[model samples]
Target: MVVVIPKKRRDGKSSFLKLVFYLSFREDNPGDIPVTADAFFDRPSTSKIAVFDRLIDYIDRHASPESQHLITHLPDGSHRILCEGVLCQTNTLSIETASSEMNAVALKNTRCKDPVYHFFLSWPETDSPTVEQIFESARHSLKALGMSDHQYVTAIHRDTDHLHCHVAANRIHPVTYKVADDAYDISKLHKASREMELKYGWTRTNGCHVINENNRIVRSCSKEKSMPDDAKKLEYYSDQESLYGYAVRECRPEISEILKADSIYWERIHAVLIRAGLELKKKDRGLAIYDRVHPEQTPFKASSLHPQLTLSKLVPRIGEFENAPRVMEFKNEQGEVTLTNYMVSSHYDDRLHLRDHQARMTRRLERAEAREELKLRYQTDKKEAKCPSFDAKNRFRTLSMTFRFRRAHVCVAVRDPLMRKLAWHVLAFEREKAMAELRLKLKEERAHWYRAPENRRLSYRVWVEQQALKGDKAAISQLRGWAYQAKRDERTAYLSDTVIECAVSDDIAPVELKGYTHHIHRDGVILYKKEGVTQMIDRGETIEMARPFENEGDNMVAGLHLAEQKSGEKRVFSGPREYVEKACSLVRDLNEMGETSLTLTDSLQQKRVCEIRPQDKPAPISFDSPNLTP
Candidate 1:
């Protein structure tokens, strides 16, 4: 099933560039495998802006050896750059340039509180699509949401079992500078997901919007039978079966059977509900079912469960709306007061146990850390008390004396009219300095207290993340489930690992090439990166290149020289016509100058090398490009 999730930042501090970086890089350990695919759509005239430069530098910095830590699984010197492309950009701007333009356009519109619209399109573990398919899906989905003209950055990640795509789009138009309409966005997304599932032959999942009998998209529930917004949220976040859902799934059929009696009454309905550990109660002029154990929770509306269970329908059939008897007369076959006990869900017990265990561990660790911190604080206080310069009592006495002297001076000056003004000004200046010092000291102390390790308690979410990093499969599953839940919340983007494995050769020793930062994977796959250039040398069998710009042939040639030097063999050169011609020219010049023995073959002479192509052109631009005059 395909899930479309729109993410929003409740704090109103979202940034386009920040979202781009997050989607394109790993958060747990920044130096590991980065983006699997990165692309841009609907950008401005040029990409040679300052923002693009900064982005390139940022990527290069992270890929450097200095960023690697022990936790990084890659070899000590290697870094990986998977793939990057550009689509529907004016002037055919690069992804970096397009992202920079997106941020600039967003900054121009101050009225729009959130200019960046972030969302995710995810598929289940059973379905896996190629990189091309992911890009195609993103384009189709964005067009469905009326965002074909918006500037956006998309990246595909493969860190988890399921493959997902992240699209960070600018809400403000480039030329019009108006915010895009987002009304009924969830409905639009549901319709889009349904379309994709049908087109791609994917498994279908339940949603609020569905295709109707007329073959047109429509909402599934009527206004009266629709679920409350709060109940929907509860179902999304908890993941466990909600009380309302439990009633409909387990009790609705039995209630229907009871209503088929020859002469129905309130007692029969009550007895059936009582056996199922549920009770029917009057709720705001309507009948609702509440779980016997969780009376405080939200109840399921009778009409929402089944039409026959509604108060209007039940009252007409059973004579009047009579309340269930309060006597202890109902009993199940087991002679127990209740049977078929209601549970949140089958997994509730496991979730509860995990939650309790985590809480206990957190509390124990916090207590131990707190005691150690207290001991250290007490020792520090003792040392400070011993030092006369750090004595609190002396400082208090000095402050008191200063205050008294200032007040006495002011009083004396007030008696002499000429000197009163001068004395008051001097006293005020001294008082301001003293207050400033006190405020600064207080700020420093507060900061130190908050920054202390012992003062920062671990939350359940953070604890789960820590465990997942430690390779706990259960923790990983829980974390992934949380991501699925957040699809309904739509408040944050979820990212997983993006590690890719490449073939490695054991015969060749590592070679350090000039002007390129070398990143070696744990399995001996070496990646070389420079400005506007990315080349991967997996042992000796294959040479891969990432060309995100129009003109970087010199850098590519330099990388190829290094690859040939390390491999000690002649490699075929195959790519687009332009790149092939350029490689031939450069290699010929080098061989003639006696600098190297290099050979080149064009696409016509040999089979073409796989090339990373831009996505199909997006729908026509919504706004005209701004005309520039010099």
Candidate 2:
């Protein structure tokens, strides 16, 4: 959450001296500061004073003891020589190397040689180091910035702490200084900062968002609804645009404001001051490359706040004063004692998960890629198997031709099952229409004088009368029977009482019905003439058949055919039991071939199904005089 405020963010509202005022006062009084600072001392840092004072006020009101401490930078002008304080400034540098060359690009893209840029360096008390360590670390950090194709240069000033450093690097390549190609160029720097922080555990004190996939939609739903429980994960989804008073440009949201007709992305980020609340500042055109969202969230700036609250006094107030203030001490009675400087053991460790997760991800990616390569090599001419020239292996090949399709279903669980159950109601309606046509055609085949359905003027009553006059007994009976069945079918099919008399029914012509049912459909799930039984399976419903036969013919030839829903346009498996069993098995195999199975995805299929084969079949006996069943 480290954010930088550009010079143009405000009209010199927060300066270096004022920043100092805030910090100095924060040490004295918690948040008790006048809105206006009429009483003032002519200190060198006015903005820094204001910033420090605000920070103290913020900490006193909001920060916990564990959270409130200030990181300081020892500016270049305070060095001394031979016990004599010098007016001249001396600067040093330090750099760190990254493990992976790919990750080292950030350090390679910056170029800086100036001293004032030291304004950004963190100045912890012990950061100062010997001149040798300073130059060596500087070279490492510079190498991190990179050079060449996409390279940068960095200069560090480590003279302050034992090994403290400042990196003045450009966001773009040093030789090219390439302008960013996004909504803004500064975002590049923000991303670079984030990469550095994540890869290296650098702490940023600005507001941070919790990284999650569903953050935005979940936030919107919770905000719009009365969801107290949903609010827990909402914290990390917000953006941090302010630090003390600096503006950070990140997380612009797409919104359609009241006055605006079209939608535009609005800058939505918060500023962090110990106790400051959320701020929803809007940017009309969106953030520019160098633009800061809202720079002066607080009333002060940094340069003015540093001096009076030196590491010496402010440390005790925040209660983080680490080193003893005692320069030298002695005691003499019967014995004498003297003091010398000694370093405390360090208590810090690097983030281990960062490296570990990266390694796992890389390995999995390599495995996936290897699988892809194997498939590619086998697809040389998929036109023919084994080039016919190598007919020896035509039945089988040593190399696997397996591939993972991009859209292959790996695994699925239905989120809503009821919707699926409702959809099957339509299928029942279609079957009913087909059944009615089949009955009508049977009457026509008996020479019943029924007008063609194509004739709009022919009424159902008139058609029945004409058929009855022809003296076709079978035709009359079937006509009557079909009418009753159609009504029954329509009533039994739907979830609601309403029946569908749609185009499929009305469009069935009298002539078309003559041979409309030349091929009978016997879906295994719902067949009216299946084994002297009529089945009506609901959507998501499945049927299992007991193995009826387990033997083949000795002197008799046996044929076992598997049928799935009579091979109709809509497969429902209302056919013979043997056919049904085979259909289900084949389908199960196809489903298992997929990484994610169809049955797993189907919300209606809530129960598990398994079918076991007998593995042995008795021989069937055949007799010409007397038919013997196996």
Candidate 3:
């Protein structure tokens, strides 16, 4: 048995006294009452009195029921009868002037800051004393708490399964004219209740024990009571359950569809709950749904009903719904960009996703432009070169070869030499620019490898590799642990790029000839083959050659190889056809004049080559050249 001091809740627009009186005595509005009633068993007495003796008699009559006799023990070892019988009367407390007098006392003690000492004395419904015993126990407990000199009333309510009493004691003592402080009253009541239980021979229940769901003490049987027959229970059933069972069941298909699609909002669940006579209300800790008819009952947690209704689950869905506006960027044929919708929703993630999508679209658009540029360059080069177009042999291929040969020959007389040279120069510049970008990207990739994550160790694997080289045992262990993550990390691996390298082949034409393959290797080397010699001409100054030679008639097969030092490495020079022809003519003149025995020094050859440098180089001398005989 526990004398529970429930927090007093004021009735709407009611004074303190009136609210307390209504809580202890009313029957019309259940919300006003402090305690629920199970059944009206008996009203032993009812009266309206202000006289001291009359108040005592009123209590005497109310405490003694017809079915139970009241016995009081005196200090002189004598016993007396305290009450008579039950009285059938109307609600006397509701019509009494006690409220007004209490109100007057309350007004007189305006300085008093205490609240009405209003509380309930509840017992377990299954095992409790009779009404007379409960009334006597409450009276004795209230007096022991220093409320004996105060005007108070006790209403025994049996409307609930438990037999309980509602006590509304005025805090301002009428005689002492002093305000009462009932701060320690709860501790006194607990002690008194324990003594009363032993004195009255009732079942002893523990106090300040069992905790309810709200972390408050379960002071009464009311906290443990099951739902009334008329009140609805929220239960998961295959057929029907809860007040809004039909609506809840109706949402199954929508839930399935939403889950399958993984989209939309939680509006379907909200609508379902609303249709089922339930509403979602915010609590301090979470969200709960309650039945309209029985809101006083324990509410069903939204999460308890279903996994989908949890706060975490609903946040993203609700966020998506609340932020459902799409803003897209469209480009006109004139290349002007415009937003499809001028207004967008005020959600950060929505704007972020939109920005990401637009960026991807822009990248795709750039790639398309790059492809178009490549096609346009191909067409322009073909138009610039005056090469013969053949349907079987590609016109683009013929144009490309002629343009490359004219550019590579450096001094050759070919149709539209300047335009072909410009075309070749632009292609080389573009390739070099592309290679520079790739190199920069590769450098960034190497930096990214150092920042790659380790295996669940919150460190970088690059540091571990450094430690492993120093033979640190811990670093070795860390390295082993980090290896798995390193393998998993795509960034840690070497990212490859298209690098520029010179390619050598025998099928290509020589620098002097114009036919077949005509692509310059990325290293700026032009490879060409003519007669029995294959030539590799490097841009700027140097050239190299590989050949087989034979003596024809009086012409000597003297293979004079000259090497020039570039960056401390010797590079061979392959002569232009005109220069070679001039050199051969000079040599033939020397031999005819019988000057074969003359010493040929580097200075003499350099002077002669400088003299012929002003003339534009001609194509390679074929076997049919007028100056050559086979």
Quick one: best TM-score, which candidate? 1
| Residue pairs in clash, model 1 | 75-521, 77-519, 77-520, 78-519, 78-520, 79-519, 159-497
TM-score of each: 0.47, 0.16, 0.26
Q: C-alpha displacement of 491 in model 1, angstroms? A: 22
lDDT of 3 by residue, 182-225 (tens): 77777678767777766765666665333345534345442222
lDDT of 2 by residue, 1-630 (tens): 233333322332322223222212222211111111122112333354455554455435453434333222234322211101101112211111111121233334344221111113232343334443443343343333342123222223222222233333323442454422223323433444444434444443222222234322111122221212222122112111123212111111111121132321111111221112223322332211111223333322221222222334333444332222222335478565554332111111111111112223343243334434433533542323221222323312311111112112111232345643444454446545645665566556433322333322323333333433343322222232233222222222322111111111111111111111111111111111224332221111222222223222100001111122111112233345444344344345444556223232222221222442334222335564366543
Per-residue error at 47 for model 2, in Å? Answer: 16
Cα lDDT for residue 505, candidate 3 = 13
**Alpha-carbon shift of residue 278 in model 3 (angstroms):** 23
Off by over 4 Å in 3: 9-26, 29-95, 209-630
Displacement of the residue 211 alpha carbon in candidate 2, Å: 5.1
* C-alpha local distance difference test of each model: 0.54, 0.27, 0.43
Of candidates 2 and 1, the better by lDDT:
1
**Span of ten consecutive residues with least summed lDDT in model 1:** 494-503
| Model 2 TM | 0.16
